[model samples]
Target: MTLGRTSTVPLADLVRRPELGLVVLAGADRLDRPIRWAHVSELRDPVPYLLGGELLLTAGVNFPEDVDGYVRGLVAAGVQALGFGVTPVYDEVPASLVDACVRQGLPLVALPATTPFLAVSQAVGVALAAAEHAELRWLSEAQAALTRAALRPNPLPTLVTALADLSDWWCALLDDAVVAKAGIEEIDPVVVHMARRLRAVSGRRSGSTEVGSWHVVGYPVAAARVLVVGAARPFSVADRAVIAVALALLALADRSDGRSVTKMLLGDDPHEGYRVVRGQRKARGDAEIDLGTGLVDADGDRMRAIVTTVPDVVAAQTAGWLLAVSSPVGVGDLPSADREAARMLERAVAAGRPVTVDDGVSGLVDPEAAARFAATVLAPLATRPELVETLRIWLACNGNWDRTAAELGVHRNSVRHRIGVVARELGVDLADTQRRMELWFALRWSD
Candidate 1:
């Protein structure tokens, strides 16, 4: 029932049609209001079925005794204008109905005896069809303009500007350290708060919140990146469709840029495989020299390099640089490799040596595989958080009852009871070293 802006026909235009023989009886200044549809209802109270922007045609067959209340109800239901058809029951609009409509500022149109209600309905339908066709053309042009903007050298700013113009709202792209904005110099603090909340919940793709007179909507485009738009009114169907297109374009632009960097840093053939090398250095120069590439990215005090292979000798000989090498992985798996490399780098810094994914005791570096395995093994205690925590603590303490009890602030007997329960639930022998090792690996990998 929601009509697009371009699909709406003004009441004044409908009344101007000569064949309808329509006469404006009241609220002449309100004739420009948009009419979405025409409905002929004889029911005394049909407000529940109306969705606004309606030109309700009634012949006064079941006219309500409380004329003022009836006109007020129509106005409240968002009926654009009331059309009184001249039927045998009421040859003309009643004086009471006219007075009520005039008081309520609801437009009233009188239909002649010669003009069938069907004629007015057909007129409105034809206007709507024409408007819809025009709207489609405009949308197509706007999409083309946005697409062109996305292909520019620096597309982020261009995209923001184009989206702002298209939506008639302020648009911003928020990253961790920088914000790109258009149609506004400074972002409202309320919008910034909403963006932060949206980022905290990663699984949410899009959301809307109200700030004063503005309605803010945010959509996640990448990890730690969001596109936000603020407007005075709620977004219509056309606006949302355009936003979806913009999101897709933005994602493509980001990936395209990232792929170029990946090729330049690693190699032209990414699928051939690569290893992410990380080093702790105050400056990025030393790590870049050791890694044989100036394409190293500095994250705070750590430098990361994506290369075809690991330089073990350089890693071992470097003085202040602690190094870690990820297991060989294709370009598509680089995100996983980057995460594993970060963990390995932490362990290397702790042990004062280079570490690799294989250095771990378990072959569960692949996060998805590890999660599935853990879920399968721990299915019995999945719904029992306290029991899961007790088992994990007991495992961490090397299955020592006294240590686990001290860590958990519980009695030794309680630890013993929980361990017994876990053993029974898992159907495993905690006394066997091999079974204990397997469980320990599952716990570590799952974390």
Candidate 2:
């Protein structure tokens, strides 16, 4: 089977090769890092002259009196293991070095006197090149798979599946890492670490996981990163590039880069297209224009177009035309131009319009979604039925004890007591903005 480019043959796999005449003091299964090749040398203090993972070969020209120090130096310098070739100068593996290696947990191979060091080094180098070549072949296959998928009328699903197969792992596409996707139920620690690092480095969401024997790949879609995790022993390089290309294409398609017109009109970056304007009330700060829009003063025009003359834009399956407006307005302003656009789009779809947008879009969405999300903060108190609803009401009233008490038909002191109870149950800091935002998002379900 073709392997992806990101794949590496495990070090253990190399050890399993029967033709190498290689001796194993260390097992072949170690994959903590990659071995570039094997090295053969005659120096006693090879540490100074050597790089790590050399599969070191030495004839012990100046064998150490204090072998512990020598072994420590090798390990410290990143040597994977030691192979001592017995020669006339040192006819047997030194007892001191062997003891030191065993004590330090470094792998030590006893090289046969009849076997030349060159043979061992040559064998390892050949294996490494072959492994790398195999990875390239795997990557070529992945590219072919993508080409086939792209030829399909609807390529999203096919492309995603092809990615999964190439990585040899289960995968999930995310609009935001926070938002979960189908077939990806949990985020493993390794995947999370890689995702965060890649996002920080690339300013794009990406992640990979090595669960048990398999390697997983994750990258962004919309605002989220797609997670592909499998049980293969190692990941190939080609697989990594394939993932990068696949995600890039997804972003190009304007699907997972979080560049929704809603996001843009709300003043988020669209990467390559569209512009967004946040209201003074919302105050997200800064404006964005899509490079593809082909306009100067793009944000300004985009705003004007939406409010003064344009029709609503509809999402594929959802009802209503999508419209965005700026400035302050009360939550009661539902069904305004923006809301109407959503409604109109829904109606148009009901008729025959593929999509529509309206310029008069303005209005606050019902806060109920956010409120319900916030109520999740009280979920832990589910066991305390007497206090659950009361806690929700207190928090809902903006932590106003008097108002909460009035609503709960109880005294202010009782409201305060119940809030304390709720706070204790939720295990959240009432004062931290981040924590509060989580609760708020849950209440509004917007986050």
Candidate 3:
């Protein structure tokens, strides 16, 4: 209910009420059309001051003959309803005016002979004010309802119900599967948009959006995500605000552990998680590990990183030395928290004791750790300049002598010989996929 930025009274409700005094009333079908209200003054060209929806009042000062041109002019001006004021100059509601209105089906209202035009104007003004008040009240109630729903013990249920109520349509919460939560009997395409946004936002760290006519607010929920979505068929401002509040509440309710990488790297027990390297064993660990510094190719550049995790002797031996990477803390200027974390891991390994690389972020000690260990162990073999390229090509081809030979333009026998030299130097069986994998990483680490 809005009128000229003032309060809005529904035209339907305003018309039905009797105290407003309707000497003649326009039917809703005509009034409901696209209408913008304006007060006009020019008797010669009423259409000029009219922006349509005008209850044009006149004392028949310049009543046109035949009425055809005058009525057509009003229609062309996009007038939704007409109000004629009767005075001594025009003592009666003219038969011509009524005939024209009936012919066109353009609603016609007669301002009473006793009633001044001022009274009609005042009534419309009052209706506008009422409409505005109703709009404000609707917004307030909607916000309160959404707020209450957000705090409920089972928030999703409350949210779905709220959305249905707001939109006056059925709603559903869908993950991989659709859960019919509340509102109408079946799912609508509009609600489907809401579900998709909710799922998409679950994986991202931040951000929100408005989709179609509806305002969809998504938040991370425990083991799931949630969205409160709705608006009247096309959605409105009030509905958007309500959904936004619901999303905020859901976010607050369910928080997550930011230490996913740490938990995974630590293995079982944090106390004795890291493996120790001694002489030959240290050489083997080094062969499998890669510190990632300066290993670049035509395709992509490699960034150096250190992964330090809680010590687990068995897990480290099995998984190789852990190195932390892929953190939110980007590799920037040295002496940052991330740089410090890398330093901690390096120091722990250098000290030959299980140590924790805690820089207030998570750690990763997995296949990446094994890659680092392999590189360290194979450093001596890689130093032989002649053998370096040969071993690299062979491993890259997965020890396939023929493919390695073709890539390197060497004979199969020569390729086999170079591979043997690498295997013997690294003290591993090149024929074993597992052993080949270890040597492969060692070569990468050395690079």
TM-score of each: 0.54, 0.46, 0.42
User: Which one wins on TM-score?
Assistant: 1
TM for candidate 3 is 0.42
Error of 2 at 252 (Å): 4.7
Q: Rank the candidates by lDDT, best first.
A: 1, 2, 3
**Which is superior by TM-score, 1 or 2?**
1
Q: Write the per-residue lDDT of candidate 3 for residues 1-447, one digit (tens) a residue.
A: 332122333344434546544454344365444223425353756777677666566767767775767878888987766767667677777887788787877676665676666766676677665666766776676666766555443555666677567545445555655543675455455555655665666454422345455444433344465443433344445545555555565454333122323443443454422221211133332223222111111111112332333224345435444333222222232236444444445533544433343322212233356456866777667468667788778878766789989998989998778777877887767778888666655554443
Q: lDDT score, residue 207, model 2?
A: 54
C-alpha local distance difference test of each model: 0.78, 0.54, 0.53
Q: Which stretches of candidate 1 lie over 4 Å from their true place?
A: 1-7, 16-21, 48-51, 87-91, 176-178, 261-447
lDDT of 2: 0.54
Give, for candidate 3, the lowest lDDT window spanning 10 residues: 293-302
Residues 192-281, model 2: lDDT tens digits: 666666555545454555676656666555444444445455554455677767666655544522343344344343232221221111
Between prediction 1 and prediction 2, the one with superior lDDT is: 1
Model 1 quality (TM-score): 0.54
